[model samples]
Target chain A: QQQVKQSPQSLIVQKGGISIINCAYENTAFDYFPWYQQFPGKGPALLITIRPDVSEKKEGRFTISFNKSAKQFSLHIMDSQPGDSATYFCAASMRNDYKLSFGAGTTVTVRA
Target chain B: DTAVSQTPKYLVTQMGNDKSIKCEQNLGHDTMYWYKQDSKKFLKIMFSYNNKELIINETVPNRFSPKSPDKAHLNLHINSLELGDSAVYFCASSSAGGAETQYFGPGTRLLVL
Candidate 1:
């Protein structure tokens, strides 16, 4: 069972553009949503996270727009750069869950 | 210093062989986890150990086992090598309790023929 669903398995965007990736989960008990970024041959690092208490949280060029009622959350990278080309994953977990349930993964390519 | 690191970044072995992928974290985190990313790129947790204690063990086969000799180290051992076992294995560590942010290792790519 796929708990979290992410769209557009692969995305290509131009530099200085915004790169967006969306994810949704069926479990309403999920309170924590995090977006992770991974470059080739490296581990996924935490990009941004949302607690569901706020509708939107922005940090510099990264933003996470969350909709609790819609069970959807999207990550927006403003002014995307070619260095941002990598795979991204959206994960969700309940407050008590020890393991994170990750989405399939989205490969983002920012063309120079 | 690296937070979480895994040894043998690339592994290649034959069927019916045995291998081990070692992981260590200098972050002093109590909880460590092993995640496998398949060909489809779906990352899933295989096992988790906290302070050398087994906390979470997913529905992985018995051939796969995790040994935590200490709080900072958790090694995964595979009894039998198979083609289906090929994947990128990641080791991650985190502080606090559940739902905490985790730090991940680069990953160990395993290839079995």
Candidate 2:
């Protein structure tokens, strides 16, 4: 069973446009929500993360909006660029549990 | 210097053979993890170690074993490899605790024929 579910398996956005990916989780114990970006043939890198205490966290053009009450979170990329084309994975984990439960993944493409 | 490095970036072995992937981190992190990424690009954590002690084992097969000789080194050994085991294995390290930022290695692509 997939603990975290992500929508729009693939996304295509024009450069400078807004690209959004949504995720939902059923585990209430999950307090940490992190987004990872992976390029082809490379390991995943942490993009942005949010805790249940914060509704939103922004890093540069990447932002993570988290709703603890709804058990949902979303990633927003502002000014999408061609270099932003990659796979994005949304993950959740409890404070005590070190293992992260990841969503299937979303492939993002930004056309210049 | 690379934070996390894995040796034998590509491994191709026949079924029933044994193989091992070695990972080392220079970041001096106390926690290390091994993740497997399948064709669908789903990253799954197989094992985690903190300070050279096993912390998390995620119902992986018995054939897969992880050994941490030291806090900075973690290695994965597989016995009787199967075709289904073909995937890219990544090693990552985190400081402070498991909930901290994680740095990942490039990855080791393994193929079991």
Candidate 3:
């Protein structure tokens, strides 16, 4: 069973536009939510992360809006650029847990 | 320097062959994990090791075994490889306590024909 579910398997946006990806999880034990960005032929890198304590976390153009009660979180990329085009994954893990449940992943395409 | 590194970036072998993938972390982390990504891009945890000890072992097949010789190295050995085993395997590492902020290797793409 997939612990985390993500929507919009793939999306395309124009440069300077906004790209949003949404994810939800049923596991309430999860506390740490992280978003990873992966490029072709490369490993997924930690783009940003958030704790349940906060409702939202933003780092530069990447923002993660989290709703603890709703068990949902979304990633928003402002001013989307071609460089930001890649696969994005949302993952959730419990505190002190070694396993991270990942979503199916979303492929974002930015057109220049 | 690569925080996490894996040997054999690509492996192509026949079915029923035995193979091994090695992983090393230079970040001085104590926890290491192996994850497999299928063709559909679904990632799942296979195993985890902490301080050279087995911690988490998911519901994977018995043909797959993980060995942690030391805190810095974790290797996976697969016997009687099947075509379903063809996928991308990634190695990751993180600090001991928090166990978050994992750094991943470039990944090893394995193809069993």
Q: Put down candidate 1 lDDT per residue, B1-113, tens digits, no spaces.
A: 88999999999999999999999999989999999998877798999987788989989999999999999999999988889999999999988555799999999999999
Candidate 2 regions exceeding 4 Å error are none
TM-score, per-candidate, Cα-based? 0.97, 0.96, 0.97
Q: Which ten residues in a row have the lowest lDDT in candidate 2 chain B?
A: B94-103
TM-score of chain A of each: 0.98, 0.98, 0.98
- Per-candidate clashes come to 0, 0, 0
User: lDDT per residue, candidate 1, A6-70, as tens digits?
Assistant: 98799999999999999999999898898988888899999889998999999999999999899
lDDT of 2 by residue, A48-109 (tens): 88999998888999988988888999999999999999999999988877778889999999
Ranking by DockQ: 1, 2, 3
Per-candidate Cα RMSD to the true structure, in Å, reads: 1.0, 1.1, 1.0
Q: How does chain B score by TM in each prediction?
A: 0.97, 0.98, 0.97
**Docking class for candidate 2:** medium
DockQ score, prediction 2: 0.70
- Looking at model 1, residue B95 earns an lDDT score of 89
State the lDDT of candidate 2 residue by residue for B5-97, as single tens digits.
998899999999999999999998999999999999988899999999999899899999999999999999999999999999999999855
| Interface RMSD, candidates in the order listed | 1.3, 1.4, 1.7
For all the predictions, what are the DockQ values?
Answer: 0.76, 0.70, 0.67
Give me candidate 1's TM-score against the actual structure: 0.97
